[model samples]
Target: MTRSARRTRRTTRSLQVAGVSAAALLALSACSSSDDASSDSSSTPKSSSSPKLTGTVTVFAAASLKESFTSLGKEFEQAHPGTKVTFNFGGSDTLAASITGGAPADVFAAASPKTMAIVTDKKDAATTPATFVRNQLEIATLPGNPDKVSSLKDLTTSDLKVVLCDKTVPCGAAAQKALDASHLKLTPVSYEQDVKSALTKVELNEADAAVVYKTDVKAAGDKVEGVEFPESADAINDYPIALLKDAPNAEAATAFIALVQSPEGQKVLTAAGFLKPTA
Candidate 1:
């Protein structure tokens, strides 16, 4: 052959080798970039599922929840350092109205689902309310079982001077249901605005008897006597709780709610004579 032909063949071979090296380098660079991207993605922190709670939480609860919820409130504050809890306890219906009226509260706990419905209907609740406890009606009497009040029908006695919660309140509603279930009608001496008021009438001997919650009677201690009637079973009030839609301290409110449904909270409520929510 010829020397020029040999040289041309050598040059082509060298070009081929250079092209292969360049392709290999490109592939290695791409692989390294992909690895670096994956590593960066893995190193990124993920968002937490639960928000960190701080600050104050205002809770609006039923009148009957005064004793139990107050205890739980203290516990919640202890569990969460740098947190404060304030409460407004009143008739369930009244509290519901206050919340719907734009009361700046973080949480709401009602004695009856019907009352809680008022808040839910107005979209004042942040989430679906949950029943945390059950309450039953009882005849609260001036200490020592005076007037011989035995059953729900006994409240109908004309001479007893009985006081009842207005039908608008949960306690009154439950009491009316129990009386209706027993086929009895009673005309109370007065209709109070809340359970505490009705219970107070009996405590002060202003009325011979009042249809109030068992918890109220228990909390009253020696001041009033409690009588349980079978008809109360037909009118059990399911207590529900929820965080408000425009809660000032949303995270703290949520944590407070969880604490109420926790075992420790159940213990405190049961001790105050509230029934456990049925399965």
Candidate 2:
């Protein structure tokens, strides 16, 4: 153990310690760099997988669907948050025309297959139309049987003022078909533009009888009485529903469509007096 030898040994040991410390610092720096790189990668924007449907949905439906669609619209809003359902209720033909003409619409429910065909032809429909319900003609009169109009044959009487929808509307077309099948032609005082208007005339006691859907009579409550005629079966109009291609919120539109076809929707529609589709 000479002093120089001891000093050299100590100095060599210190150098080794310094080398080890430098290596440890380098290792820590590498690990820190790796963690930062990993953090950046993880934080990088990725395609979101969460499904969120938020927007406005516009529905164009036949005037006949007013009551049923109003309830369904409220239900849809409750089921989907951040969504507003705006309904445009009018004649099926008119609604189809509006939709096909580039009107913004999320869905459409028509009172007749023919009207639905118009949208399908224009490729405005997102999917195949499905029949949800059917409706038949009924003889609606004042609650007290003022006209005593009991049979289809009785409608031909010259004294009774009858109101009928124009051939353009579904009910009117059906009434025409039924009358043609029955070989009975009754003169109507006025050719109403739509079924509701035809029914409204009866409701207001403006006309003695109007050929309208049974559901319309029911929806009118006690304002009018419904007379079921056997010939009505010959002219049942099928109701159809479809999602529009220009839907603003696709997810919500799909969900709403599913809801309408569901059992709950069926029940709601039935409660509104709509008959289930046979097909």
Q: Among these predicted structures, which one has the highest lDDT? A: 1
lDDT of 1 by residue, 1-279 (tens): 799999999999999999999999999999999999999999999877754567999999999999999899899988888899999999999999999999899999999999999999999999899999998889988888978898888888888899999999999999888888888999999999899999999888899999999999999999989898999999999999999999999988988999999999999999999999989
Q: TM-score for each prediction?
A: 0.82, 0.80
CA-lDDT, candidates in order: 0.92, 0.88
TM-score result, candidate 2: 0.80
**Candidate 1: clashing pairs of residues:** none
User: Model 2, range 114-175, lDDT digits (tens) per residue?
Assistant: 98999999888888999988887899998877888888888899999899988888888999
Off by over 4 Å in 2: 1-50
At residue 26, give the lDDT of candidate 2.
Answer: 100
Query: Model 1 segments beyond 4 Å from truth?
Result: 1-52
What lDDT is obtained when candidate 1 is compared to the true structure?
0.92
Query: Model 2: C-alpha RMSD to truth?
Result: 6.1
Using TM-score as the measure, the top candidate is 1
